[model samples]
Target: MDFPTMGDLADKWLEVHARVPNGFMKGRPFTQSDWQFWCTANFYRVRVGAEFVHPDDATDENPVLLNQAFVYRRAQVVAPQKTGKGPWTAAIVALEAVGPSVFAGWAEGGEVYRCSDFGCPCGWGEKSHRVPAFVYQDGEPMGMRHPSPLIQLTANSEEQVKNVYRPLSAMIRQGPLSELLLIREGFIRIVGESGDDEADRIDVVSSSARSRLGNPISFAVQDESGTYTTTNKMVEVAETQRRSAAGMGGRSLETTNAWNPVENSTAQRTFEAKSDDVFKFFRQPPAHLSYKNKRERRQIHEHVYKGSPWVDLNSIEAEAAELMQSDAAQAERFFGNRLVAGDGQWMDMPKWATKAAKRDLPFGAKVCLGFDGSDNDDFTGIRLETLDYYQFTPTYGAANRRTLWEPKAWGGRIPKDEVRAAVEEICAKYNVVRAYLDPQFWETEIDEWASKYGDKVFVKWPTNRITSMWASLERFQGDVYDKDARFRHDDDDQVKIHVANAVIRARGLDPATEKRRYFLGKLTDHQKFDYAMSSVLAHEAVCDAIAGGALEEEPDEYVYF
Candidate 1:
């Protein structure tokens, strides 16, 4: 007969079952045979394919008859899959008045009969693979896979087939099956006090494991005695014949939920290799060796020489000694021998200062002026100097000490109008080319001067007070020591020489407090003098610009009124 599609069959089954009284069996009184018949009839609606007819004399009195009836009926429903690659299925069957002994005996008896030459006419009478089995009574099957040697639950009775094997078979047929094999057993146990009469006796020790494999083989023993106990033991056995080929490095193997020995071993090996001290050298080398040796040495040299030596021992000391003994007479006589030295105090100036005063202030000559304003009865002063323009002036008394050029000053203090007037006069007189004016005293006054002078007057207002002062001083010192900068004046008596000497002397004085002390005896106020000193220190850029011949862009037009 042609079978209908699964959809059609399911629909018909649902309709027929819908008519059965729901929960009616709970209150109804029925014999076991009656219940069995009813269950069989309802199950028969589906085409189970197999014939399941009981013998004419089958009865509850004969255990064999009952077993036959149950097995036969189950066989019908335990139908083979139409596609044929699966295990059989069965229903749960309950038994009354059965014990562990009877359960074990039944299984043993069945096994004996099935394995015998004069086989009982059960389906197992023919040679067939022993499909796995599991039994459950109180609880539902845990849905574990087969050929799993570990059985989580079991019962000891002929009904064990219903409790165990039926569930096991159903589970096996459910696809996505594992290759692992499981052998298990089920049993029952009792507990409580001996004299209590009514102890908490219950089922226990329901499952056991027979064998396992993959990476490490394991076996389990489940005890159904008093407090149920399950113990699993693992043994590491090498896979000689089944060894994997070394593809890449490590072997890849299929796995189950259980621990795998091969993977653990491989992981351990990998960890050891990575953590070994021998590999550290390759990972990180010495920092010094990583850089180019010559480059590193060059960098060190540059840093050391960034600032020049503080004193030009060969020239400065010798010249200072020679000039120390001479007065204005010797100075003038020395100037007479030098072509560059001019008349006036320029002769008495230090050799360097004398040479500087003789130098020409051409339009493009590098020039810078530092102004000290008169504040609090202080005298305002302005100092000027040309950079890199030098002329030699001879000193007859100190013939061995040839003078170097130095800076000159054009400054003094009077009234605000006088300061302004003096600045204008200097700007006109000396072609006082470029002048820097202190902006603090009267910003408007300096602005007026700058307006009159145009690009010739540069108003310098200290913005970043401390940082600018420090940076300017550092640059000035650096340029001086490096011989990259020099004062442009004729002699030690020139305004430039006096200002430099005063500044140096002020710096050398020990302050009574942490703050620097400036004597107002030589100026109007200490603060203005300090500011003037800072401006002097800040002239390094002006000096460098002059020496480099770029002073026209912006001259150090610092002027004092």
Candidate 2:
């Protein structure tokens, strides 16, 4: 038998291997030496087709043959380096085109291995060459189709491996390839020396080989307790490298690619109070030295006493006393410093009593009148008082004396004309100051009063917003018991005392019924007062307005019937 030259051997090998079992030769097989010789010796004999091809013949004398050979000379085989484990790497290459004989030789040499057909006995060759033929050895294929490489590694121990691979196999058999890939890629890793138990140890060497060969391989290790202990570090590194490269071109890395510390630690500083500075949610307001430690109590007192815009007690009482005693004899009669006749009962009087016969009313005297209107059978009249009364005076001086007076005291409902006449007479007699008239009557009555009084008599529209009334009551209750303030009247002294007593009692009255009782007391008859009370109660807005300052005092002109 004659031994063939390297070129002849390569040609024969190509010829036999080209006719695959599938009838078409997608690729040809060559030994390492045959490949080298073909690449160098027949460098000019092969033709370069769209892919790679060997020409049928080559001759130096044939021009066409020379061109074809020249094309082949430029051609090169694209042999990618094996990447992963021996079995995985070999199985991937075997699926590509090299003939079964070459695969067998590679497998026997432990350089590569054939992977069995997933389920078909014809092997990958029966699958239209779409699946590469693989090298096999020792009755075991490079890779098995039923249990994946990861599953096989995990199945090392019956007790430890059973849990992981059993479920994994079930999932792979029933689930899609994408799902299987996820489970394999996500959960697989190699075992470190820390986990050397057969159940725990991972075939890291095999996994590393598969990774280097560009095979999609993953491995994971578990402890004897079946807890994952080792992970595929290469996969992590590759992913990181891929993300870094992508980010270099202004691509954003996925959130998963970002590194996060296993334990997050931070430092914080808190502010502490120094010797000079103190921390408090609220600071105390400035203190008045005289009132010093009693600042809060003093503030409450000031708010209660001086906060109102109307009815300044210090000024009004002084002015009223001075004015009433402007004429000496009239002063002697009016300010006699003793109780006399024709005096109306005073309400909200101070604790002290003094004769008004020698008292003098001062300038800028403000007298406020409170009127309680009556129905047909009730007495309709006004009560006048001075804001000039001492809020809390200890001295009982004549000029500073205070007095409250009700001029006309008729009981049964007087005619409107008669009420107007009496009001005019009282204003003329006492030189009346500001009068706040009750305006619960008909609008015509108010128009008449406004036309008559012009501005001196304030026709106050009733209201239920009783802030002023409450404020006035607060002031009166606070100041009335102070001994320095006094009340004096010549006639109807008892009535003045009664009025003062009534006011004192009423001060303690509850607000809901206070106004109604006030109106009832001022009426001519109880029956009529009851009727008027109903009307006043019905007109809550009007009553509230009067109690507030919504209505101003009218002018001081006289009114005709």
Candidate 3:
């Protein structure tokens, strides 16, 4: 269900109080760009003053009030560089600090909002620009200021924190907001009756650990989350702030450029999370456009920076080209707003994403199976590939036809019976000609399968063999990037995540012969790559089946009904 928003009030409030922080339009009344307004509107959207009741079964006998009426607990915006994230964040901070940001109740009609009503000196009757008024319409949502707003402006480092902090200071100093806000050396305090009230202030929080980090905050702005990672402990800081905000019925906003997938940064994790309470806005350029091509790169820039008219396409192109001279992937990620992989990434994610054409395989289709197993501390899964090479896990099928199984999801051990039954069911439904089973920890199961199904159908394909595994990986990569490739996979989220998590690991030169080989490894110990391995084994089985003539076409016979 959707709710009415206080975006109109917020917009008008900023028009009277906020100002452009810097550049040629410095000190001018701030106006939101189209994208900025959209984000703000969605973030502020909230429920009316109504008690919670189950939509399926509701009764006046029992109703519960919600702790917070916000539709989203947090919001993230992923955009290109120089897209006005800084000034926009500063404006939001100011709004949270003094403006009517919280949902109050529904208005019947003929009500007006005045700065004097909230203890400010501004008024609508004043001939000057300090006064602002908001006339409420019938049934419109009203807004109220937080009594004590404690905001945190955070980033990976002190220098990065200035991205928002500097703009905030400038806006407060250059506008009517200066009358109510007291700009300090490291923070800004919202002036109260006694003046310089410490309870209502916006503080700069950087990567350096602070003792008061867990203090309950009214709102928080996480800047440049793309660089917040475990190494600097910024990820932990972000989590801490959110937990504190939840305690105070507050929310957070994260702003960043597109991130490197391999870094496992905060922005990447937030973007990939399956939580329904988080709002995300990322405008990516069309997939068909190539960032490496100069002409196509310009098109990408134009698309990503569409709403922000301040960004000069020519300037962006020149900067991207210069950056591309050394770091093309970073350039694309920063300017193209694309999720590009860093060094040692085994697969190109954009190419893989482009190949997601999921379709149902007809019943009784000739297929091959691949299995990778683990007892615990990792994933166990199976992948299926048709004879003509359309790969997918049976998870998309009926509940009983499970193919991929995770150990962590099954009480820290693989569900042996369920897996065996699923395999048995698949074998009965499809004409499975070949199956490659990695027999590292499941040798007994593999042997039993070989006995139940013919030995040729189920073979122990050990993956530790560097020579063979490397060759199979090479073949899979070739097909994925090939222009006329026949390989395609199901639109499985697990497959995509596992594939993205894989990194290249060198085996160095062979001891007996000076031969070099490489294999896939996980980016981190906790990140699993089993599904990717299963995919590689499945493709290898398809190749071996074709080589052995197991897929030879049979003559068709027609029978009249």
Candidate 4:
């Protein structure tokens, strides 16, 4: 770990000048939490007596710039919503505006920093007003105010920028920060030595304004980067700010809540970036606890909300429970601090997880099987639903059970012989009441199976029919979310992964019913949802069996294989 960070000076400066922007402590001195202090310390970690130089510009002779002076060129902070990120961002902006924000040199000894020396009267030697002295120990690194700092507080919209700008305005107006800076509507100007001149300024920028984006900046704070996606054009804005900051040898700070992985947002890209000079801070909850379990969810809340003492666990629980009713993934992402696909997600993972059960049906139990087939470029799988409503795939037979087959695993083509053998083995192992086969690329196999197993047993079930497909999906979803329904499935991870990859795609309104219908679609071409579709077909088969009086009949005698 690196030592002698200028964050010590920053911490003291915020405490002396900054104030709480709102709530009960509105006008009190601002205090950094332990987590905030850690962020400040790491972001300000500097190479002693060194200057920043771009790797492209470094030659064998550039003395100060040759060394990787600054440990990090940029940094990102990921935390839960309302964890004081806005106020922390404001404090950072304040520090960059007038505090010791740049590298000066090494401290020899006995060098003290007093406000009086910096054209201010807030010092011990002053007649009524006084401030504490920051003594520089021997061999310690020193910091100085930027010569002409320019900072931008930016987001996707003006309202989003207020997340940072509003707190900053209040901080300056409610505390001693006012003496050093003047806060207007969208600008905070630092007073220069002449009292009337502007030394530096902080501007509020959004996606709507791009004129002043090219100006050289000392620092920038990008708030809510999770929403900075290419669709909103905030991705371009973030890239522009990085270039602007780099021009002046400055850096940026990105603060955001957890992001949806499918959106490919700026925060997601930043986290996935492999650059060593980018510092990332993300504290996820313990993996052992399942977010679907209500008891474990409270524990997860406690873990992720550790540093934020002001957060109320009971209040968070209420809000999360309510939000889970509509958007389970969002609740987990916001309160559980977990990255989950929220937008356009077809299935609520927590609801699906709640339906997970261990396979308990006896051997040779009457069951319905759903089959979806493909030759290549996709997956082929079978799902089983017992007469008692417990769903599972046969994992105990020979030949790897052959229940789930992926073309990629087998020379880019599904082995028809292996699939035939597996289907026969399943027929011999269980008293199959009904089998719904998609019969798209396997028409010949379906015709042969219908002859051998009876046409009523192996029926053609085409998934391309949007109307029936949508109805089946709706029924499965309702069963999963309805408390009164007893729908359950085997704890299969492949099924869960496929379900998570599924997204909703709406087709036009039905001609007869005049109601909009939707079906499951993959988030991307490579992310397969075949297993999830198979599960839905399996549930639909079970419903048909009950309606046709198959499950109502007496069970067949058990036969040992």
Candidate 5:
């Protein structure tokens, strides 16, 4: 029961068991491979791409695999579709099945070494790299102590695990490593061992967080986690895995591509949190690369795709161009290795961020209001925009742009009385030209609002159909993209979250005569984009007010009350 340095273990796997069953190296000899997680004798490093790359002292060169005490409990692996993610995860599973992957506790004073000079795996004779494993004598951290750990490959669906599991199953059955294990339906068992021997078996499960109940899994893999969401019982599975592995030193690995903001996948949460416990590795493309700047975009593509040299660049470019015809955001997420919201996004977030500010209009100032909400499971909101949103150079890179403008704000959820009072107060204080209320769950209240503020403001803007929703969304998109349009926000967190969750979709569209106009909505029903909708409504009302000559000087014949 001895082991060597992780570096050597990787070498042994490549030499003995690992193979390129498919791709350019299909049927060819195994080659050298490495993980982005760097380790030295006393330091484990996270390569956070540029500037932030640093290795901390501790968990040094002899890093433990699933060494809970010495490593992050979870690792999030994000890369394009075919950059060896499957092979790498499979390799980990293979080595974990049998290797000195376990930690041998703290080193006592002298060195502890176990030589691989006997019964080496790399077949073609003797190899130089993998050898001299360290044996545990006493008083050492027993890392990966599970000699036959129960590993599970969990995905949102069984089909998703096929890419990783199929190749993994093949590597064991077809490769020389089959001597160590046996593959069967619903189980990959250690040779000659019973189901009771939890230490040396792997299972592939899909969905159903309930299936993992009471199971003590030594390690788990969430495959293609970008699609694993709250709806698919991902949150439940994650919690279950952690609870099951609690104190037993169980660990999990997640592999996924960039997810749409609407998806709100577990991978998105992990990457965004930047938690200490979750080790993340991503080859992200540079932001601010203008679509017009083809050269910069190409360079970003080259840099992000350097890991996949075997993938044809010419083919990628061609495919990328073709994909752009449908969804450029998807093309970026896959080919450019960029973690972006999907093509259904209503607004460019980076463009939207530029308009963020901290401003409040005077209580008596002329403005328009937007109201959106639901009965439950979604937030209710009210937002105000000035009567006129003139175009200006947005706040680009903090260089004297937007010095004078006040940031717009989203009024958060409150009681019905507060909402009504706020509406009445705003109408009384400001020359409220119009109010657009999405009358879904609040039809009665909306009718009351129309009666209370009908003369001063045009208040009935129901978002029920094609004409109503499209009008608002079209004007909003223009306000976002056009430098002349003014649609700024007060940098509210709700605005960002709600907007981030919004996706552009052609709802209730006709195939033949009428061209499809997109409206902003959630990526999925569970995700809420209320604030975004309110913003759209606010913009639409402002446009209406403007069209009604709200911004024009009153004629001498016009009388005021």
Candidate 6:
């Protein structure tokens, strides 16, 4: 109806720049006449990952038709380094500046956007043929109408503007759209006639950003957003832009490098944002891309970098290998496209998922419990491990699948009554051998559990003893990979999420040797891994029990007395 659909607009966009040879194409002039021959943007059309896809195309099975206008208000794309982030962003901005990006009204059947030059018989042909352009119906902006729009570009510094704004200006200055933009002092003015005007300008918002809170921004681009943390106030600036846009039904986009988790960057927050309005595109390395296997890692390197084919694989590989020697985490984050947790993430997500065991565990089964208590900020975890049971399967997807060790439970807050009831239920249903509780904010709950089930099961395993926790974590890592001593859990999102979020940090010296040791932690304060921590202590409980002595099944020598 509106034009063709969003796909057609994308098709038109690719066609329009079809002859605009990228620098990679021998730095040559437009030698080919066909739009496809001149540009590299269409490659995305052939193989677009979710991040690059149009918002209307939400699902592969049923992509939404983009006939009319429905520009998403906010889009946050967090990708690893060296992807075509800059090029694609530049292209999108240019299109919005002066292209058929907005919705015109619905078209009946075969409609075309006729060019105004009647003497020349000019027309928006082929790619945009039979597509609708914005037209007046009731003295309104038919489909997409911004007579004079202002777009702002903000980053950490003026220098950072080069990341997006420089390329953006260049694309308009050199590409077919050059005629429309007049390079002005403070803005690039887009107009039909050759003159600067307030109606349409793309401005680079200042770094201080104190006075930018209430500007009328039709579109805003926050570049290098990974650096926009709470302390920097860049995120607040972006939020202000979003608010400003909302008043005019405008929108904003954030282009960021893969953010550091501990930084709590706006990029990180956007990735974690769980709202329908906030669209996100975060393409990271698959967790299975492990450094342990060289060939696999190389193959995955090629795969993850598909979004940016211009990168020199040979150079990236060499640099990554060298970086791995000193900083594997950095290499992983920058090139491998993996989000690293300060070089101390406990386990790889794909590797952990490989250990998922789709099995059944019911009431009355013997299990060891690990409890991590939280009152408000954090969550409470009640983890159960198999009662030292194993099935020797030498050949499975994951070497030695933990047939019985399954992560079974979790709760949002420390629901005192519910937790007490859960502990009571656990104790009554199973032969609870060891229930290790960390008594932090949950002193009352831990004490109550000890009183109720202490005699039947082991109680609070002091986490303050840094030495013991260090040992427990060490054992747990070993168990994760020992194929013969594999760790596992059910396919519950909570368990998977907690496991993926788990981080390890070297903290507190061993009381005896005065040597620092690693303990479980979250990369960011907002990240949750208390559930996984509970599992660690629970697994540790079993380890300690097995180390001491197996619980002997009390002899059923019941003499009728």
The best candidate in terms of TM-score: 3
Mark the regions of model 2 whose C-alpha exceeds 4 Å error after superposition.
1-368, 390-411, 427-433, 455-457, 461-465, 486-491, 497-561
In Å, residue 233's CA in model 2 sits off its true spot by: 99
Better of 5 and 6 by lDDT: 5
Model 2: per-residue Cα lDDT over 195-226, one tens digit each: 22123212222223333222232222221111
Over 1-561, each residue of candidate 3 has an lDDT whose tens digit, in order, gives 145788888988888889998889999989999999989888887755543343245345542222266677899999999999999999999988888787766788878877766656656424454444578888777776676788899998889998898888899888778888888877788976344567788888888835559999989999999999998898999999999998877889999999877778899889878798898999988777889899999999999998899999999999999999999989999999998776788987777777777888778899999888888777888999998889998853465545777776688888888888888888888888999989988999888988999999999999999888988998998898886898888868878888888889998776666767799898677567899999999999999998999777877989999
In candidate 5, what are the lDDT values of residues 86-143, reduced to their tens digit?
A: 8767766665565334554444534433323222243323335343334443433323
Clashes per model (N, Cα, C within 3 A): 56, 79, 0, 0, 30, 7
Candidate 5 colliding pairs, count = 30
What is the C-alpha lDDT profile of model 4 across 400-506, one tens digit per residue?
65488888678999988888887888888888889888989999999998899989998899999999999999898999888678888886867776788799999
The lDDT values for all models are: 0.28, 0.29, 0.84, 0.81, 0.62, 0.60
lDDT tens digits, residue span 81-181, model 6: 66666655665565556554444444454454433321112234434444344232332221232445677878888787767776666666664556666
Higher-scoring candidate on lDDT, 1 or 4: 4
User: Once model 4 is optimally superposed onto the true structure by TM-score, how far is the C-alpha of residue 561 displaced, in angstroms?
Assistant: 50
> Candidate 5 versus the native: TM-score?
0.57
Q: Candidate 5 lDDT (Cα, whole model)?
A: 0.62
**Cα-based lDDT at residue 263, candidate 4:** 76
Each prediction's TM-score versus the true structure? 0.25, 0.23, 0.84, 0.61, 0.57, 0.70
Clash pairs, model 4 backbone: none
- Alpha carbon lDDT at 505, candidate 3: 94
Q: Which regions of candidate 5 fall more than 4 Å away from where they truly are? A: 1-71, 108-145, 156-159, 169-179, 184-186, 191-199, 207-214, 229-243, 260-276, 290-300, 323-332, 338-344, 353-376, 379-497, 503-520, 530-561
